[model samples]
Target: MSFFYSSIVKFEIEFFGHENIRSNHQKTIEITKESHLTPQGDCIVGVNATSSCADLPLELKNKLKNSNSKIKFTISVGDDEFILEGRGHPELILAHTKDIVIRKSDFICPRTLAIKCDKASDLLPRTMVSLLQNPKTKGTFTIDID
Candidate 1:
């Protein structure tokens, strides 16, 4: 006989208005319910929005719309913001950038960030494992609010 084990985790990321935009830009952003498993073993996030009027350019918006993978943004322990791109499983490709931040009062546990993995081994090299393992780090992980 043969046996296999599979597990899945779901996360939510909230988009906050850009720095230059008003605190309440009043734009609408939508996320879809479709989920994917990344190669690294993380759930691929989904967003479904009919329209978004935020400051994001049309090209970027299109990119988000056409993206068939899980897209994530996070603030590293060093306070640098990064975007994690994955397809069909947790094959996380990290993109370093300066345009990410953590917002308070957005959820019950604002610091609870979600990490996706396709293989358990991929997490062995991450420092976030300890933080994510902590029971305190349990909040809805969102990518963008709008």
Candidate 2:
């Protein structure tokens, strides 16, 4: 009789660093579920008028619709304001998330905002990203409606 035993090592890695968390912390910004502060100090924002985020400000909605091909929006975090430019696909935000089907019900055509950060790492926190993309999460960001 021969006995064979195998041990599979499952390593869970964390991508977020101190700078990444700092970049996302202490800033009161309405982040639509699509918005997330990447470990690289960058943020991914979504500009959409889907039913899920219809409650957003009218001006913001207009900007999202009229911006059309343009991918730039001014946002406020804590006291500082930044101009977020559109880069990645809106669906990319979804793909970055875990359970996308639950939150994404209707077929929404939303634009993307790829904000850059100077002090971010190439890696991100898996836990934080999970919360950002959670179905129960509501996307919100604090910006000047005027």
Output the number of the TM-score-best candidate.
2
TM-scores, each model vs. reference: 0.24, 0.26
The clash count for each model shown is 32, 11
User: Taking the tens digit of each residue's C-alpha lDDT, what string does model 1 give over 65-117?
Assistant: 33253444332322323343322212212221212212121221211122231
Each model's C-alpha lDDT? 0.26, 0.29
Residue 72 displacement in candidate 2 (angstroms): 3.6
Model 2 spans > 4 angstroms off: 1-30, 33-52, 57-63, 67-71, 87-146
> How much lDDT does candidate 1 score?
0.26
What shift in Å separates residue 50 of candidate 1 from its native position after superposition? 21
Write model 2 residue lDDT over 45-105, tens digit each, in one string. 2222132333444444444333232333343222333443332222322222211111111
Model 2: weakest 10-residue lDDT segment is 97-106
* Model 1: lDDT of residue 116: 30
